[model samples]
Target: MMPDLPEQKGFLEQEANQFFEESFSGFLIADEKNRIIRSNKRVSAWLGISPEEIKSKKISDILSIGSKIYFETHLSPLLKMQGYFEEILVELNGAAGKRLKILINAKESASKEDGLKLIYYTLVEASDRVQFEQNLQHGKSRAEKELEAERENVILREQLIAVLGHDLRNPLGAISMTVGLLERSIKDERQKKLLQILKRSSYRMNELIGNVMDFARTRLGEGIVISPREIDLKPVLEHVVEELKFLFPDRKITVDIALPEPIHCDADRIAQLASNLLANALTHGNPQSPVSFTASNETNKLELSVANDGEPIPESLQAILFTPFKREGNRPSKNGLGLGLYIADQIAKAHGANLSFTSNEEETRFIFAMEC
Candidate 1:
């Protein structure tokens, strides 16, 4: 199967020439001065120029303006120092203002005899890969911009709620004063009942306004501000119970307090917490059953609880019970802003206490416990 030495050498030379002409990538040979000594047919096809015209031109002649600067300033120096470079991204100028993206590899020929230097280059088209990278970068920028805009909108909306809640308080105060003045002169039985209704509605509105302002403040990151001191919490709880009983005369609310010592807490805030809990029970508990409220201090631990007979809280709702603006969706009365329990929980947290609850077919109970 062996051929003669002269015939084997000829066959190898023919095979190498065939491969050089048939390669998919563009090819070029340049001297040390950077002038193209030879270029393949593929290079002529890519640039829309004839092979005869491409020869003797500098390699930078076909590069885009930006790529030309990069080659002279960075790529060329790096190639000479390292003797080779591969997979460098660059763009070539093509016909009709088109840009042909390509990955280029270049190397200096190993032979350096008689001061002769040659460089070989291979250029591969990379249009699809480059376009995909550009698209990914564009999407990332758009998402970041959208997220920043949403954050600004949320801050603006919370500020608006705070301003509106503050302005409404003055007018609300005037209405309450007018109702008080009219109550003193009213004597008719039916008229007195109507006045009582107005009084209850005004009281409810006041409670709602307070909750709105608190909600906005907390959402805006101000949080619940409290001043704690040693105080008798029993009277505070009792006062809240009496106020709620007056608000709903037909409903019965039972209370038991056995605090023998003062506890360190913000009295006004504790009263507000108790009031919110009592109001929620009156609104949602079974009409025929009485709400049970109890406060006690045992071994320096303060524990307060409110319980009432009612339908058990839904499993799904219990998870978000302390989240603002959420309420029992199936309940008949949806009059509130649903911030009562949320505000109460926040107040407890501000005082380093825990507010927890339990619900079942028999009763639903909320307990607030803290160390005195």
Candidate 2:
């Protein structure tokens, strides 16, 4: 802390007056009746008047009409009781009819025995300060408008994505049905094989559309929807496995399910989450190893896990494993909109459950646990 000042002799009236005349502020002294008793050269120059002329005029003569009224109604009563006021905004009616903004700090300097009182005032130019604040407020308003516009554009883009994803569904369904019918009637083995390829490609496209729709729904603040009921999880798991097994006949998917009791959850949504996890395993797991699914119900919860032997995921990737559209750029061969895990996680959350994972050199596994 800085040391306090030492006591010293005060300047005499002549020295004080001379210092006041040379000060930067517009300095003035006025009596209790508001007549100008004295003013410094700074104030005299500001008013475009001589010092003698300023002394001859009332202080109100230099004030704008509004400030003169404010001074009488507010500042005078406040100073009378409190003996001082600081940084009060007032305007002066300039000699050329231009109004100049001023910041005033005033104090009661003397209260004589004869009931005469004197006040000291320092006036500062406030036009630049007020203009700067206005400019700052305008800039803030412009920034807010730009932000709002950007938000609206994002909403429009999400709406377009949702519409496109929805419209593609009917055509995709027709294509799948047409291909299935052709596969059943085809006599040539080679034509049958080509039909299978078409069928698989169409299914992949359909899955991509579904993921995009789910992602758009989430962005629009509509989370996954589920209808709860007591249902066996075994059938849901089997259905997903059987379909995936049909698509990838060369790969093996084995299921081992033993439920302690019926689960209270959304059966279709459970199937979807399981399907997504299986797809991830099939796409990323080593082709030589089979993907394994095991599900069981404990006394307090129903648990399902999918495991595959593959190169372990990097530790950095685990942090964003369930985030939407967070795919590794290096894996260009992978086909997805990167929404499967995110949608599965949302589904699990909607059912008041959690999706978690573990990975090492041996295998990567995803677990879904739902409390009863």
Candidate 3:
């Protein structure tokens, strides 16, 4: 390519210089020591200084105290190491103590013979961007604090429930004892019937209390406690099925057990889990069909299942069936507090076992599997 004529070159140079001075952003030319050698018209106007006045002034002179320190300690060293720097945020001090947040870009170019090699800088106003970042940081901090507070509130609520559940046990026991004694002394048939009703209601209340306490214990991070022992689970399974039958005499229950050897387990908790599953089956089973209980203690593992024939549980409800306080849509909410399955599942987990279920138009079954 051939060089342009001098007049034509002068015209292009003038046009380029005009665009550089009148551009929207600020621009500066500084010597190797960071002394301002020249500045564009826009920068001079924004800082309330003429181009002539800005010349020979150190960049530190136009920066806020903090920015001045950062520029010298970090920005300068980084620019020296990399020969280029971009988007380095700095607060520029202007006339009348005004401050402007700006993003700076600095680059080292070829040395000039005219006077000294210079650093070229470009600055963009970043007040809004800085404010946006600050707002984001503030919102993040607020969310974290709120989440922590919510967790504490849940812990406190669980503690209170546990305390209340514990306190009710003594009075409940007294009431149960009194009711039994009253039944023994009563002679009238009607009075005996009333005592029976009282006993039933008391038993139900006691079960509810137990559920609440267990829920509290789990939520408060103290899981269900168990005392494991070597024992045959056949009798335990039979007794639990018998108890459920006694509670709901109208409901038919069938039990099949194959435990011929001792199994290490917490019998009380196992019985509770069995009762819970049976009760659920009774609540939702086909009235004419018998609820089935099956247990097998093979050499490797123990498996127990409770099944009843009825309408299939809704698919959505099945997903959360073992979560606390959630009842199936078709089930009566007034019948119980909706904790039976949840407590049973938790007990299974504590025992290093699993409680699972399957439901269809024909039947719904809750099955427990455990290591022998």
Candidate 4:
């Protein structure tokens, strides 16, 4: 049940009086005729008058002429109609006729039995109010500029993607097609070899473009987007091995995959990741010793690894191996931008997996593992 309103009013009034007495801001109680009946110590200090001497002073006597006119003309009528007026900017006549800018809040209250009215006033320095408003405006402006810049950045990235996907790829596609047509007509062995070189260069160029697009999307755009579904992962692995074997004909790549059931994954992305890892192994591994490709899907887990016999990756480089455009400084094969491993790692991450590696004097192995 609600407490009696008269009792609540009495309790609230006592609390309000305590609050006004301890407040840093000036407080005053005035009669209906605007004669000050009581003033807090803060008001006495600002006015350079004793509390007892401040009593019986008219509110207009302490206000600047302009503020006195404003109080009588606007604020007084507003308070009478609404019973309160808050945050009205005004000026007070301080000691020695100095002007003090302030904000005042005044409320009119009446005694329940006698109907005698009293006005309570709260005074605060306007300097703090002005500073707070300035800070708020500055923050709002900064946020708006940042939001606009982000929108512009998004537009630029989309344009980059369109150019990479359509404009650049279309020309590269034409070159590949023309190379295929010329190979059939060429008869001289030297000419044929040159054409073959051109073909391989085009293929490499296309691969580099694909890597760049994937990097931009995963790092700059949203992230590696995947269409995950149940897929026969064994065939996907086998295809990647076959493709890499064709590209690096002399380098042997041994595979051991045992996925007895369909695995849930983004098959094409997984294939791309496998191809990247395997290609990196072929490029750096000891030619005489075969690169090892292994995978297994068992008991709600999927794991794949590519191992190559090589000198150990440097400890410093290992820490930043998955970082884009970073590579082993000591390594010799510097064919393309160092994005292959970075893209591979991104693909692994897209599938809720992590790509990790360990290196020793004997071999370097990269592994991708996740819950299926």
The lDDT of each candidate is 0.91, 0.86, 0.88, 0.86
Give the clash count for model 2: 0
| Per-residue C-alpha lDDT of model 2 across residues 180-242, encoded as one tens digit per residue | 899878999999888989998898888888888888888899978789999877877888889
Best by TM-score: 3
- Tens-place lDDT per residue, model 1, 156-248, is 998888899899889989988988998999999899898888888888988998898899899889999999999988878888898899899
lDDT score of residue 197 within candidate 3: 78
Note the residue pairs that clash in candidate 4.
Answer: none
RMSD for each model, in Å, please? 3.9, 3.7, 2.6, 8.3
TM-score of 3: 0.90
- How displaced is residue 95 in candidate 1, in Å? 2.8
The sequence of per-residue lDDT tens digits that candidate 3 reaches over residues 2-110 is: 8899999999999989989989889998889999988998777668888999999898888999999999999999888989899989998865678989999999877
Whichever of 2 and 3 has more lDDT, that candidate is: 3
Which residue ranges in model 4 land beyond 4 Å of their true spot?
Answer: 1-29, 32-34, 37-122, 185-187, 219-222, 228-232, 259-264, 283-289, 298-300, 311-320, 325-337, 370-372
Task: Report clashes for each candidate as comma-separated counts.
Answer: 0, 0, 0, 0
Candidate 4, after superposition: displacement of residue 176 in Å? 2.0
Off by over 4 Å in 3: 1-19, 113-115
Report the lDDT tens digits of candidate 4 across residue range 1-372: 976799889999999888877788999999888899999888887788888988999888889999999989998888878999999988888878777888899988866477888999999978667779899999999999999999889868866874676568889999999989998998999998888778877877777888888877775566888899999999889988887776676788889999999988999989989989998888878888999999998778999999999888888888888888897778777667888999899998888898999899889999999898
Runs of candidate 1 with Cα error greater than 4 angstroms are 1-42, 50-56, 82-88, 105-124, 128-136
Counting only residues 3 or more apart in sequence or on different chains, how many pairs clash (N, Cα, C under 3 Å) in candidate 3? 0
Q: Between prediction 1 and prediction 3, which has the larger lDDT?
A: 1
